[model samples]
Target: MTSNSTTYEGGCTCRQVRYRMTAKPLFVHCCHCRWCQRETGTAFALNAMIEADRVELLSGEPEPVMTPSASGRGQKIWRCPTCRIAVWSNYGSAGDAVRFVRVGSLDEPDRLPPDIHIFTSSKQPWVVLPEGAPAVTEYYDTKKTWPAESLARREALRAKRS
Candidate 1:
């Protein structure tokens, strides 16, 4: 919305759902939590945290499927009806205002690397975090980890949330 040029386009595996991130994300998270590993069937889940309003739908709509989370607060996973591939999710804390876009679903996932690695305590033994990459045993306080610009963006989004 602020004349951002870094846009990312992506979609589901079946191409049933297409979307574009209008601006850079607030922050990216590479979660190694057990829930993430189980849900993604992989070692981790890379998510680009962004304001929901910044995500523009380009094609089909994604159906929101309510799913259980480790916090027991539940999460709404938005997936393509045709492929059933999750594109993003709305967590209970963020409500429907924020979206955790699956980085793997992006057309150029490598363009947005994880800003931080979370829940590393549950990370797979075979996966060794890069030397210098920010890794935390659990979640982190955004005030301490995120950049000032990102924190400001988050604050703006927070005002918009109901």
Candidate 2:
């Protein structure tokens, strides 16, 4: 979704898991893998990939579930206990350094639509991708192709770190 500002707010079904994203997403992706299908109980998973530092929890905490990773380690997944809605996840390898928020849980549900699809090899045969949408058999990092505005924000952050 297009907006004048980068910030967006979201919460769980019961509104008990409010959160604020302080910046625009670095990238958006649609995951068609079986794992995502089963987890979301949908055809695909839409994610607004953002900097972990830009996400803030503004309400109640979510219950944590640690699921084993593809490499056998565990990753912490946070969800709303009442709705069992997956709110966010702390990717295992980085040990809670980065997170992937479930864009469906956002208050502005229409704000971020997937511009690309990941794990297309596992997509259901009946599901057709949109014309001109980029698809990949596996994951693609966004750093190489972030939109101009987001790239500038990332560079500014990097400069601050240095």
- Can you list the residue pairs that collide in candidate 1? none
Candidates in order, TM-scores: namely 0.95, 0.82
Tens-digit per-residue lDDT, 1-162, candidate 1? 123358998999999899999889999999999999988899999999999989999999999999899999999999999999999999998888899999999988888999999999999999988899999999999999999988998888777663
Whole-model Cα lDDT of every candidate shown, in order: 0.92, 0.78
**TM value for model 1:** 0.95
Write down the lDDT that model 2 would get.
0.78
lDDT of candidate 2 over 1-162, digit per residue (tens) = 225477888878888888888877877778897777877789988877676788898988889997765656766778987887788876665455456778888877787888789999999999998888888898776675567886777677566656
lDDT of 2 at 127: 94
Worst 10 residues of 1 by lDDT: 1-10
